[model samples]
Every structure is written in structure tokens, then in C-alpha cells.
Target: MTPLPIAAPLTIAIDGPAAAGKGTLAKRLAAHYGLPYLDTGLLYRAVGRLADEQGVDLDDAEAAGAVARALDAGAIDEAALRGREAGELASRVAAHPPVRAALEAFQRAFAADPRGAVLDGRDIGTVICPGARVKIFVTASAEVRARRRTDELAAKGRTVEYERILAEVRERDARDAGRAAAPLKPAADARLLDTSELDIETAFRAACAIVDQAPH
Candidate 1:
């Protein structure tokens, strides 16, 4: 695919629930547009992992906020922050207002890149970059998302039950959507893309179309 022409700084914010394929779409869009991509959810996951490693109570806002403040976003071990555990921990820590505030600056800075950037997370469009040039809320049915997540983990040699994964996916969705701090929801102006039946290639092409049609 040819790189899209970028006449000015363009920020693309992709927000969605777990395993909704937003992360993959964001990375592809970033590459297509020659922009930097940031998986903002990893920031929260890193904080959660650090807090757990330090034996801090995950529910303690003060402790989690401190972890968030001290996090080295660039130094996060992406390999370790994958799978069900990290996702649950991230959801827990992300609900704390202080934790969200501490990490907000980093996301804002990343979105301010002069060239361009693509950020994907629960609240990228609603909170991190409300004024982003393009905002996409990519989603799929809970069952589909759970199946994808289960397959992903199994491929990594971790045996997981579909029923349990589905339940966990629903639980995470409830927690994420109910959280007082930056609850997961589509931005008012964000275009919605339901990827329940679409493959990654189709989703990427659809996302690119959204970006192309948006006012630059």
C-alpha cells in the first residue's frame, strides 16, 4: 500500500474495548500515514504490572497513581504486559482518577507529534485527543472478542477455556464502561466501525477510508 499524503500534523485516535482489533488497526493506519503509533493502553498495563510487582494494593489509588507517575513509558516490557492478567490489572488501575491524570500528559505529548500519530486505547478519542483529526471507535461483539482473545492466548501456549474467557471479557467491559474516570465510550464525533465479521485487512482498508474522507 502507498503511504497516505500528510500535509500537516494528523492525529488518529482509535478507541474500543479489549480484543476489538483497534490496536492492530491503529498500527496499520500509523504506518500507512507515516505517523508514530502509541498503544496507550500499555501505559496503564505497565503501571498495573509495576504495582503488582511491588506488592501494592491494586485498589489503592494513591499507590497506583504513584506507579503511574513513576512509569517509564518508553521502557515498558511489552512482552510481559499481554494476556488476560495484564488486561484485568490495567482495567483496575485505569479506573483511578489520579492514575489517569498522571499518565494523561504522556498521551497528550505523544499525540502532539508534529508529523502525526495514531493512539489506541479505551479513551483515546474521548479524553486523550478529543480534537484528533480522525477518531474511530472500533468494536466487535463480546463473543467474537472473547474468541479472538482465547485463540491468541492458546497460540502462546496458554490453555484457556472459552466460557471463562467470555465471562472475563464481559466483566472487563462492564468495569471499563462503568469506571468514573474516562469510561470507555465513543467520542461524539467519532466514526463507529463494527468489526464482528471483518478481518484485519478489511478493517484496515475501512479505517484508511475513514481517514481519507476526514477533513485534514
Candidate 2:
């Protein structure tokens, strides 16, 4: 991979709520800069899916933590963690402190790479990589995010209701912000990007500008 124009150890943390485009933006930025990229949220999703498969109570902290501890992040079936049910399960499991603690080391180690990496998740900026050289908080209105998610699911041949998705989006926002462990919030120094009115290309350009302006 080609190195970024910036200096070494240029960790970039991108944080946001569901369907806000952080994942898409992070992938694009990672490609542009030739950095390894991680969607940290997938860690929780995988754990949640595994716990569910094992018939563990979704709200059981110990059970969820066990799943997280035993997780082989590389072996997670990404295809199975792509829908609303997986998202809800992930949110519940992620609320457990033990679950977060179990996954923290892996995320930090990835960020510690000398070649740098781009990580996107709810707490990437605030908890996982507070000292990252660049941080971005991507967000959009709940309605807009819900529409995006609904359209995405529809494209996949899944029938979904906009109202239901909107409610879920709001519910997730409240749960994420109110959670005791690593509650979702922007880092103090993170640049904010509201994609409610921006297309992917426009959002990508804005994110690129933010990274370009970071002190290298």
C-alpha cells in the first residue's frame, strides 16, 4: 500500500451513530491514504451475533463478554451482521462494560500501528483513540439516517418501513448516548461533519480536507 502524504503514526478516528456514513467515509479515506481500515462497530456486532447464536441472553453481561473474549475478529462473518436485528443485538451487548473492555485492546493495537490506520465506530474518537492525530464526528438527522438505512435494506431486497427505522434510529441514539460504558459522543477536538445534506462525494471531500489540515 502507498503511504499517506502525512507523517507516520497518523491515526484517524472517525466516530458516529448508525447509518451516518462514517463507515463509507472511513473506507474511502483509508483507500485514499493507503491506510489499514477497521470498522470497530463490527467487533460488537460479531460478538452480539455469536452470543445470540449460542442462546445467551442478550442482556447478560458475562455471557456477552465471554463471546467478545473468544471472538476471532478476522473470522467474523460480515455477511450475517448487516441488518436491523444484528444492529439491535449489538447495541444491547455493547452496553456491557465487560464487552467493551474485552475489545478495547484489539482496537488500540490496531491504532498503534506505525504505518497508521483509520478506525470508525461510536467511540473511536472518545474512547478507543483519544490521542489519534485526527478525529471526525460524522452525523446526520435521524430522519435522514433512517431513510438511508431503509433504502439500503430495500436495495438488498429486504422490506422495511421508514417509520419503524426512524424510531429505531432514535432509540439507538438515546441508548448509545445514555450507556454507562463508552457512551457515544464526540471527542473534544473532533471536527464535526453533518452529512444530512451532503452526498457521499461531498462528504468525502470535506473529510479529506479535515485530514489534510491535521498537524502531521
Show the lowest summed lDDT stretch of 10 residues, model 2: 2-11
Q: Which residue pairs collide, candidate 2?
A: none
Per-prediction TM-score: 0.95, 0.95
- The segments of candidate 1 whose C-alpha lies over 4 angstroms from its true place after superposition are 1-8
In model 1, residue pairs whose N, Cα or C atoms come closer than 3 Å (at least 3 residues apart or on different chains), thus clashing, are none
* Deviation from native of the Cα of residue 106 in model 2, angstroms: 0.5
lDDT score for candidate 2 against the true structure: 0.94
Q: Candidate 2 — which residues are off by over 4 angstroms? A: 1-8
Q: Give the top-scoring candidate (lDDT).
A: 2
